[model samples]
Target: MKAFVVTLVALAVLGPQIARAEGGFKVEPSMLTDWKTVYGQVEAKDSIPARARLGGTLVELSVTEGDLVEAGQELGRVVDAKIAFQINAIDAQIAALESQMANAERELTRGEELKSRGVITTQQLDALRTQAEVVSQQLEAQRASRQVTEQQATEGAVLAPVAGRVLEVPVAKGAVVMAGESIATIAGGGFFLRLSVPERFAGTMKEGDAISIDTAAGEISGKLAKIYPLIEGGRVNADVEVADLNSEFVGARVLVKLPLAARDAILVPAEMVKTHSGLDFVIVATAQGPMERAVVPGPMTKVNGQPMMEILSGLTGGEEVLAHEH
Candidate 1:
């Protein structure tokens, strides 16, 4: 414990020295491209909203934002109070009507027996028969109305129509919602990177053109999926589809490298490049000592299964660089 405490104190005292100690890098020339990098955003290919087919107050919301859902998944419950009450009322009316029909049938049987024994008149039997028929028809109508109400009640459960990640749930629990109102916004798993390119490069860009996406998971390749017909503010918008990525990039910003034309560049080992205040620099060896020179670094690439960066400007070929080891 004593040694540990001493180490902590030493680290606190040497914090500034440790931060300032950075290694230097060397530079070399290689064939590279002057590719133009345009900022792009990864978006869902088709973001569809899951809507409520029946109107009611939203209740028991189960799906949350960013939750993955499958087809036929229950997102929440909708309580249509009026429909429930109507069903109950219809049920009660059906019960009463059924009881009345039973009594009318018994009375019609008695009237038939009396008429056969000549104990009742034919007009009385005819009246009893008409009453029984009318009661049966009324019962059927009530049952049909009840079925409609029950169907409405069954539709109260909100269901997801597609398999995807839920992007947003706009309505809150206990909020009154109308039929066809969107309950959740879902991105249907298919993702694409959206690139806004300058209109000057429109003729150069074509469908299926290859591009690279710079992300936290390093760089990956994608292709142009579409080109829009309209150009806004001197920029043409297009979508690039990348495989093997989930919805993680669905609204994330990524650096997109579009091939412009090829040019000669100074290639250096990736580790040799140092950064300060977002600017890249390399060390050059002179008779006096090692000197730091600012250099604009381009896209990172592999020259022979080894990572390298292209230097866009700063040094011409064959400059002796100082490679400092940390």
Candidate 2:
């Protein structure tokens, strides 16, 4: 008992030197960001539907789901059999009008020759000119009508509105679709992360805030790009921009940690906390002696460029903790 008392006294005298040599940490409250863990979805910036311009049967489909396409690229062809028939009919009408126009021009030329020779009356020459003008106007009208029909035929080709991957192909080949009906849904304009957080955190969210994301490649940083004003279903929507984000799988959910607010927290040196039997412990020096107390440690952080561990419980401010040997 006497030797034990002497050993304790010696430790008390050398405690300061031991702490300085091993690197001691003071327990104090520091401000830390209060993070809220949530799931976010990888989404395309633009989700547009490729629609059919002309009502007809989809005769050819060049793309299906997960196919990449470019803007204005033909994805399918909508063939309206009636449109072809109409075009053929217009061609026939145009041919007939061209023949009539030729005949009218010949008669007008003959009339002019006769008038120059004083063989035809002025009234008769005027009649021939009038007939030729009527034929020319009719031909012009038929040509315009044919052009309109040809334009309708051109509309049968369904073109992609944007360059992106085809997400959904609603109509298959040989399926009849109406004008303005969606043929496939395309995702374009690059990729971003979409988040739906609780409305309670709306006021805390701000644009341009740094966000942490947990991805398959590991944790990555992102920025809070947008926050919507309208709230729905008690959730507030937001968009996060991440560089080099994996866009291979759109709509993939990823774990996210958002800094909602900041609060005071007690932190200690990470080396000071030791884990054993699935429970963490720290050494606290008191007048009696050094006592090993059970503690609940939170995530590791850094302070003043030094690694520190958050003490969730079993320690408080002004408590002297002994640093473990490295």
Candidate 3:
């Protein structure tokens, strides 16, 4: 009975160990994505300029470089002395026309009375009415001219074309600018990473592939959003879309890893490969019992959410590696 009790205790302690050793991972070829490291720049989707609507002097500037602005927001004011002068001239003409119109109506009224009294002929009264109509038309024309001048004056204020940060301000207060001159350069439409990849990978690159970004904070994942058809200077342009992308600095360079192709390789748990005397080895279970076989280990990878290491050489399919000892 004592012997049987001791045997039961030993079995209880070694049962789990024996099971793990017998259930070693079987090596098989699996697909792995090959990545290509490249540099990419943080770029805004749109870089537009806030332009002046009319030629004038920049009277007031409300924003500077690196300031955030909104679409259609007023960034500066321009003043054209000529525009104000034209408005004043139009007003004067309108006033003169009004006085003339009043005089013509009075003359027409007097002519009507004179005709009723038979003091004036009907032809004379008709001529007076025609004169009054001409004065009225002149007044209408002058009023319309005044409105046009006012509208031109209102357009002297420069407005932003898009919502974003101000990148460049080419003009200062009191500086002269043309109607289409840029007041400020704005970067807008959100931000994305623009990549220049080697032309040889064009055939393998595709949209919607997962991409890895190395930022100052940590590694973040992104998606390959677009691939341009044109190849410039033997480089293909691509765009990466990432949520929570850092846009603190425009034109900032970032390290990126893109999946260019896929290939089949053998992988095993990282712990399965042990290093001894500057050499790596793996314990392979075989008909002759466990044997330590020298192997070459490649980069580390993940398999089914577990950390794995790729076997570059000295391993074959259908081979089983023993569980790494603690």
lDDT of 2 by residue, 238-289 (tens): 9999997888778999998988987667777677789989999987778897
Worst 10 contiguous positions by lDDT, candidate 2 = 1-10
lDDT of 3 at 130: 99
**Across residues 192-242, which tens digit of lDDT does each residue of candidate 1 receive?**
888899999888777876777787788888888899989999999998888
Alpha-carbon lDDT, every model: 0.76, 0.82, 0.84
Best by lDDT: 3
Q: How many angstroms is residue 95 displaced in model 1 relative to the true structure, after the best TM-score fit?
A: 2.0
> Which portions of model 1 miss their true places by more than 4 Å?
1-34, 107-131, 261-326
Q: Which parts of model 3 are misplaced by more than 4 Å? A: 1-22
Model 3 lDDT at residue 320 = 73
Lowest lDDT block of 10, candidate 3: 1-10
lDDT of 3 by residue, 38-78 (tens): 99999999999999998989999999998999999999998
Best by TM-score: 3
